[model samples]
Structures are given as structure tokens and as C-alpha cells.
Target: MRFADIVIPDTSATRGALEVATAYCSPALLNHSVRAYLWAAAYAGMNGIAFDAELLYVSSMLHDIGLVKEFDSHTVPFEEAGGHLAWVFAAGAGWPVERRVRASEVIVRHMWDKVDLAEDPEGHLLELSTALDISGRRPEDFPAGLRAEVLERYPRLGLGEEFIACFRDQAERKPDSLAATFVRGGVADRIRANALDG
Candidate 1:
């Protein structure tokens, strides 16, 4: 599946991930997932970063599954729960144990403040891409043409408002979770103020 110049990995694993994500996540969230992958892939292409597109694609699709009602976990952060789900999904796809672990790790690391590209290229790309999609960080890092094309292809669909609401719910229920920390740090304001929202 190609979007603009980005070639999304077309594999059983990628297809299954997309199906599961589309079945569970809201349209806004689903689009966010796809955009996350595109952003990461584009950045990697420009920066000469080597990555496993199938792994990245699968991880990107399932990275936010925990936010949805079907997969939300009461005992852990959404990212952690999502990671577990990704692990199962990867196993179902016949991924090796190491590859499965890598998928889980990439999903879990997307919420980190930073991921060292040298340590985990895919994790670093995902972290940067999710940050860009969610909080509109480093809009200048991507070319204007690429940004416009991606946005046009997958509109935000009010992700700013929906994501803030989801985080607020997570914060209220899991006060010790990263979602709580994000709410405490005024992520709502950042989402709303994102230049990309306009």
C-alpha cells in the first residue's frame, strides 16, 4: 500500500494489524496510527536510517490499541498494555521471539521522552513520529510537501480533542500512569496548540 511516495509494507502481518486496529480504534485513532508510520518511514528515508518496515508498520498499528475499550488495561499504562497486545499479534503472525519482543519494545518506547536511534532505530523513529503526530513537535523536520500530502490523505478527524479526552479518562482512572503525567504536564494544551491542527 503506497501513500504518496511512502510504500507501506504489504504483508499478512501488516494487514492483520490494520484490521485489528481498524476494528477497535476510532477513525481518528486509526488514522493517527497510519500517519505515525508514514511520518516515521519518511523520516527514516530522509535520514538514512535503516528500519524493518513490516515491524514498524505492525507496531505502529497496534501501538495505541490499549486506548480502546476492548484492550484497555486497568493494571498498567496503555502503552504497556498495547505492547502486550502487539506481542500476541506478532506471535500470531509467526514472528520469531526476538522480533516479537522488538515489536513490543517499540510500542512501549513510543511514549518515552527520547529513544536513541543508535540503540533502537525503530523505537526512535516511532517515538519521534508519535510525538510529531500527537503534540505537533518538530513540524519543520518534515518537508512541507510531505506534510501537506500526508495530512490531506489522512485528515486529523479531531484527534486532538479525542486523544485529550482519552488521556483524561486514563489519568482519572490510572493516576500513576503516563497518561496522568501527560495530563499533568498540560498535554491538552499542547495538542490544541499544535500548528498542524490548523
Candidate 2:
């Protein structure tokens, strides 16, 4: 499935993942998820990184699910909670156990500072993509044309405010989680300063 110049994986698993994201995420978050996939896939294509499109799509779609009230965890960080949810979703999609575990790992690893592309291509792509989307880090790494097309297609839709609120709630509740660390580390300022928002 192609949206604009981006090639989305057209498969039952990918479709199912999109459906799950649409059902659970708010419009702003859902758009952010799709944009995350496009950014990652476009970067991979440009850089000659071999990746599993289906896995990346699925992981991207479900990566921030734990931020939604329906799936939020009290004790664990949102990324870990979302990773568990992705594991179950992959299993229901009839993925093999290894693939299911890989999906979970990819989602969880997106929150890390960096993921080694050689070890886990999907994880690395997702990490870079989400960082770019959320904080506007290294926007120049992607082509100017691709960035323009993606933002025009998906739009930010107040993601900066919505995401900051979600993180604030997470920080207040799970003061020890990574979300708290992000809050303490000035994630809101970073979000507001994102070049993409302009």
C-alpha cells in the first residue's frame, strides 16, 4: 500500500495492525504512528537497510498504545506496556513465537537512545523515526521531499501538546518510569521546539 510516495506494506498483518491502531489511538496519535512508519521505511530505503516492513509497520502502529488510557500500565513504563501488547497482537495475527517476540522487542527498543541496526534493523529504524517525530532530532537525515510529503499527508494535529500531556500523566503516576525521566529531562521543551511543528 502506497501513501503518496511512501510504500506501506500491504499485507493482512499490516492491515490488522492499522485497524488496531485506529481503534485505540486518538487521531493525533494515530497519525503520529503512521508517520513514524513512513519515516522509518523511507529512511531504510534511502540508506540501503534491509528491514521487515510488516514488522516495522506493526511495531510502529502499536508503539505508543500504552499511552492510551485503555492500555496504560501503572507500574511499568509505557514502552514496556506497549511491547507486551504488541506481542499479544502479533500472536493473534498467527505470527510464529519468534516473530512475536521480535515485534515486542522492536517496540520496546524504540525508547532506547540507540539501537544497533545490524543487530535489529526494525528497532533501529523505529528508534530513529520516533525520535525524529517526537523531538525533531536530525530531520536533515531524511530527504526534504520525503519530510514535506509525510507532514502534508499526516499533519502534526497537536501531537506536541497531546504527547506532552500524556507524558505528564505518566510521570505523575509512575514517577520511576522512563516517562518520568523524560519529563524531568525536558521532553516538553523538546517537543515544543520540534522543527516539524512549524
Candidate 3:
């Protein structure tokens, strides 16, 4: 069960996210998302983290769904509504209640100075995913508004500074444990072999 094979694309959240992900952000955002979910689930499984794979997978896909709809426009929201704009998009998509709620929770909590770590564990996962998405490269390439949030929420994972470091180290040294590689290769091959490209 490769990561890409399970990514449901027809949902409202996903449709909006794909547009936002491809246009507002880099392709790597989409790539890293698949990687993050795979890595997080694998790690959880190996260490007994008791995570819901489906929840993590879907939550990860939609965690940044807010980003797609709220970039650079002042009236775009992310303001007094407490990011209600993003949640509205997710909710309006007709996603299952649990998935919508979880996705909304992660999205709303992603902004630092806004995140309540103790109350939102999925938010922490979202934070960790955000940080690991760009840890090895120039910090400038990261979303300017998101850096503080990353720093604030990442440490809460209790993986320490070494958390992302460890994942990076594993990816560098042990590619099998590296989820992104498998997902990309798998997705590409699936598209090709299954004639999914249209």
C-alpha cells in the first residue's frame, strides 16, 4: 500500500489543495506531503505511536488545505474568523465529519502564536510535517509567515532538535525507511502502468 495509491483526489479539500499546492506553493509541497504521511505512519508503527493511518494520511493531505486558499490576500481571511475561511472550504467539500474536523484542526493550529500544542496533537503532526518539509535547505524558500509557527510547533513533538535530524539522517543513509522515495516512484509507476494519465 504505497502512499500515492491511497491519496483520494476527488474530495473538495483535495481539489482545492491541488490547485493551491501546484500554484501557490512548489510541486515539492505535494511531494513532501506524501513523504511526510508515509514517514510519520511508518515511524508510528515502528515505535508504537498508536496513530490512525487513514486519519494521518487524510489529515496530512488536507493539513495545509488552508494555505491554498489564503495566500497574500488581506481580505483572504486567516484573520478574525480564526481561519474559518479554510475550514469552510474543507467543510463545504462534504468530507466525513471526523476527517473534516481533524483537517480543520490541523490547518487552524498551523499558525504560530495561534497553535495550542497541548490541545492539538494533529496540529503537532502538521507542525512536524511543515518543518521537515524544508529542513535541509534554505530557510528563505519556506513560507515567510510559517517559519515561526514551524519553530514553535516542531519542538512539541518531543523528538528534540534531533527529531527532523534523525529523519533526515535516516533518509540519507537508509532509503527504505524514507517514505517519499517509495511514494514518488510508486505514484509515477502506477500512473504509467495503470494508464492513469489523462
How far in Å is the alpha carbon of 172 misplaced in model 3?
35
lDDT of 1 by residue, 95-162 (tens): 99999999999999999999999999999999999999999999988988888889999999999999
Per-residue alpha-carbon lDDT of candidate 3 for residues 1-198, written as tens digits (9 for 90 to 100): 233322343554555655645555334345555545644454344334454554455556544433333342233223213235445555666666766666656655543333444666556555554444433222333343343433333222222232333233434444543223433344323323321011
Tell me how many residue pairs clash in candidate 1: 0
Which window of ten consecutive residues has the lowest lDDT sum in model 3? Answer: 189-198
lDDT of each: 0.94, 0.93, 0.44
State, as a TM-score between 0 and 1, how close model 1 is to the true structure: 0.97
Question: What CA RMSD would candidate 3 show?
Answer: 16.1
Give the alpha carbon lDDT tens digit for every residue of 1-198 in model 2: 124656788999999999999999999999999999999998887788899999999999999999999999887999999999999998899999999999999999998989999999999999999999999999998877778878898999999999999999999999998889889999999999999998
What range of 10 consecutive residues in model 1 has the weakest lDDT sum?
A: 1-10
Whose lDDT is higher: candidate 2's or candidate 3's? 2
**Candidate achieving higher lDDT, 1 or 2:** 1
Steric clash pairs (candidate 1): none
Q: Per-prediction count of colliding residue pairs?
A: 0, 0, 0
- Model 1, 129: alpha-carbon shift in Å? 0.6
Ranking by lDDT: 1, 2, 3
Candidate 2, residue 36: lDDT: 94
- Give me the candidate number with maximum lDDT: 1
